[model samples]
Target chain A: MSRRAQENLVALVVLGVFIVAIVMAFDYGQRARMVPLPIALIGVVLTLWQLVWQNIRPADELNIDLLEVLTRREGEAVARNVSSNFDEQSAHQKRQAAGRESVACGMVLLLLGLVWVIGLLPGVFLFMLGYFLLSDHYSLPRALSYSLGLVVALYLLFVQGLGIALYHGWLEEWIRNL
Target chain B: MIDAIVAGLAALMTPQAMVFMFIGVIYGLVIGILPGLGGVVAMALLLPFTHGFEVAATLALLLGAHIATIWGSSVTGILFNVPGAAKSLTSCFDGYPMTKQGQATRALGASATGALLGGILGAIFLAVSIPLVRPIMLALGPSEYLMMALWGLTIIATFSEGSLMKGLIASVLGILIAFIGMDPVTATPRYTFDILYLMEGISFPVAMIGLFAVAEMMKLYVKGGSIVDRQMTEERSTVWQGVRDAFVHRWLIVRSSLLGVWIGVLPGVGATVGGLAAYAQAVQTSKTPERFGKGAVEGVIAPDATVGANEGGGLMPTLAFGIPGGEGMAILLVAFIGLGVVPGPDMLTKNLDLVFSMVWIIVIANIFVTIIGLGVAPYLARLPALHANLMVPAVLAVCFVGAYATRGQIEDVAMAVAFGILGYLMDKYHYSRANLVIGMVLAIMIERNLHLSLTLYGSDFLLERPVAAAMLAFIIVTTALPFVRRWWKRRKLAAAGGRA
Candidate 1:
């Protein structure tokens, strides 16, 4: 997708959520609904304004951003004063960023799944090793060293030092019983 | 007052209390340097150990750790772009840029000194203001609180990434996220959607980790570089330069420190607002406002000073009216009760020395943290040069675990991942995560107060509450001041050109 399309998609999603929230607010009693209803309505209008304004504005002009000057850093004045349009490689960069982000976020999800299934110790150990290996961050021996060291330190700190009863992996529990 | 100060010094001078205070400061730094863990978690972890300790020792440990975390939280922000806590988020604006410019040591130095001075000023302010605070606290009600929250929301004008509309949208989204759990006044779940976890609401720490740490790591992955990839400058900015910078901006430090104390006195405003407001004020007042967010020394100093002082402000309400000021204060209140100290008007009259001891702890802890922070800054500045490979996985591991640890629920990890994606998208677009956070922090306060105000005064609350009405007017005027200034400047330029 083009950069603009991606940006629009984000705005549309936010607007859709607000619309759903507005509809849901009606089901609540007067006191419960009061705040959410107006907030949702205002959100819908603001988001719509953003979407429409983005499309209609000149490509080379800056958006009528409220915090434009306030957000600028020392070197950013020149860059920020200009319009936020697609640079020559913006779409390409955006695509690459999206892909990399997905992989990174996917790794986090994998860790969560691993923790739920295998518990904190093994899950953390495996995830770190797998991430380093898969992402080509380190060689095999180095990855193992870092992962093992981290896991041991965590075990000492949390289990031994802090006396936290960590979740035992199902496999470990099964093995212990056997 | 003199007796209280002497008594406080005497109480904290005990070997056991001093030792515990040192240990607490160190432990607080460790936690504060980690993602999603802050003084709250640090205090919570130490709560169990406080049971058998002496009141002085317990206060020393608790308050010492809490004070240490204020500066400790700025470390990650200075070294990497990641803020160790929400209060530290403002530090990253100029701090991370300083790292990029190889001035990480200087930034760290300024942060330490600024925090130390801020803490001292805040303690002094609290000590002096105690007598004056009772009437002010008594005069304020829900209507006043609501206006204060609205005033806080005006800060979104400064923190937004670029577009004002996008910033407002982000703020609304943040407030909406805060509405996920049960309504404060009604007990009805607003947007839980029948999920068990939703009933408890989205964990702010978990959300913060996702928004900042997780999202930042993803950015690192995409960008493919260490935090400081450029060649190191041979001319390293000395730590003393930072100390000098803090002293040079002494006026800014004093103003921000007072702002922190003021915000701290207001129950529920918290250090987050204090930090952001200080930054906003710095930007608004600076001759070189453009230098902010790009390694301006003032940007780094102002927020640190404000947050450093906020603790003293927070203690006033808790000690005066048995009303906890913020989350950390709420936890401290619990510790106070455990220690058989009833926090009320008598706290001022009978237990005056104990209160002063708390102030002394703040002063002493600040000195300790600054010493430790400065000593480690040069060594810590070397961290940004570490390869992304080691940094990314380790940070992510800590973030995920920290998220889960906040609530000990698997679902929190999932939510962290989800919010991580959301945070990334927000960054990719123009949505301000800071604004989102401000919205979330203030949402419940705004809603609860609005309800209370309406119920008590029957919709004519503005007329009924003059203080609140005056505050609302102040908010409007302050919020418009920037735009009005810009327009006036533009008009003057145009008139000059026409004459020319």
Candidate 2:
């Protein structure tokens, strides 16, 4: 998607959230919804303004500054400068960045899933091992050593030292019940 | 007063208290450096062990660690753009930029000195303000507090450098997010949607960990570099330069410290607001306001000073009226009761010396933290130079575990991840995450106080309360001053161009 499209998508998502919130506010009593209702309404208005403004303006002119708007400053020049700085990257580079961002997001989700299924210590250890190996930044032996040593240290600090009962994971609990 | 001061010093001078103070400072520093663990956690963890210690020793340990964490949390925020606690969030604005500019040591130094000076000033204020504080506290009602929270909202303008509309929307979203759980005023769940965990509301630290830390790691992975550029790994400024910056901006430090103390004195207005307010004041007062949020030393100095002095301000109400100033002070009050210290007016009259001991501990603890902070700053400054491959996974691991450690709920980890994705998107867009956090911090305070003011004095509360009305006027003036100045400047330029 184009940068403008992405920006519009985010604005639309925000607008949706505010609309949903305002709709849900009706379910609450007067006191409960008083603050949230007004705030959500403001959000909806502001986001709609943003969506409309961004669509009408050129992509380069979309960097609207509240101060500039209030002061009626030379906003076009400022917006162009700001947008140009971010837009300096080539389309190819932007695509590459998007790919990397996707991978990063996937890795985070994978780590979260691992932690949920296998618990914190073991999950973190496995995630680190997998990341270190895949990233090709460390030797196999070094990755193993670093992962083991760090996990052991975490175990000592959180479990032994602090005496926190870490979540022992769904797998551990389920197996124990069986 | 002189006798009590001397007695307080004498009490704190004991070997037991001194040793415990040192240990507590160190422990607090460690906990503060870790993501999601703050002074409250540090003190809460030590609470179980507080049974057998001397009163002086126990207070020193609790208060000392709390004091040290103020600077400890700033270390992470400064170096990595990952604030260890919400209060330290302000530090990440300029501190991380300075780190990228190879001035991490200097930033660390300034932060330490600012914190040290703020702590000392706060301690002095606590000693002097004890007797005079009651009337001041009584004069300010919920209307005034609501005005203060509104004053904090004005800071959203400062963060709205890119897109004011987006900043406002982000802040509104943040306020809405704060309302997700049960409403305190009416005993009704506002937006839980049948989730049991949502009944308690989102944990601030957990949200913060995901927003800044986890999001930062993801950014690092995408960028394929360490936090600091390889070319900028060499230190550009010394720790002395940072310390000197703090002293050179002594007036700013003093103002920020006073702000911190005032915010601290106000019940429910924690250091989070104090730090942001100080930053707002700094930016507002700066001649070159554009330099802020782009590695301005004043930006680093103001927040640290405010947070440093906040503890001292926080202790006043907790000791005198038994009303805790913030969460950390609330924990301290629990420890106070455990140690047989009854906090009330008698605490001022009968236990004046003990109060002085706590003051003395703040002074001593700040000195120790500054010394240690300055010593390790050069080494700590090198952390941002690590490869992204090593740093990303490690930091993410810590962040995930820290999120879980925050409330010991597995659901918190999920919340952290969700916020992380949102944060990444927000950053990619022009939205200000700082404004959102500020909104979250002040939303409850504003709502609760508004409700109380309405109940107590009706809708015309602001008009009825002269002080709150004046404060409202002040907030309007301060909020408008920058825009007015900018407009005047632009008008002059336009006229000059036409004349030329």
Most accurate candidate by DockQ: 2
Compared with the true structure, model 1 gives a TM-score of 0.93
Q: lDDT of candidate 1 vs native?
A: 0.84
Candidate 2's residue-wise lDDT over B1-500, tens digit each?
99999999999888999999999999899889999999999999899989988899999999988988999999999998989898999999899989988899999999999999999998898888888888898788899999888987888876564677888999999999999898999989888999999999999999899889988898899888778876846677899999999999999999999998899999888999899889988888876777787789999999999999999999889998999999999999999889888999898999999999988999999999999999999999989999999998889988988899999999999999999998888887868887888889999999999999999999999778999999999988887776777778878999999999
Question: What is the per-residue lDDT of model 1 for residues B142-206, given as tens digits with 9 covering 90 to 100?
Answer: 99988877877887765556567788999999999999997878899888999988999998889
Q: After superposition, how far is residue B180 of candidate 2 from its true place, in Å?
A: 0.6
Enumerate clash totals for all models, in the order shown: 1, 0
Worst 10 residues of 1 chain B by lDDT: B227-236
Q: Write the per-residue lDDT of candidate 2 for residues A46-164, one digit (tens) a residue.
A: 99888888888766777764435665643222134445545777888888989999999999999999999999999999999999999899999999999998888788877786678
Segments of candidate 2 deviating more than 4 angstroms:
A65-67, A72-91, B491-500
Go through the candidates in order and give each one's C-alpha lDDT: 0.84, 0.89
Residue B362 miss distance in model 1 (angstroms)? 0.6
TM-score of chain B of 1: 0.95
Chain B TM-score, all predictions listed: 0.95, 0.98
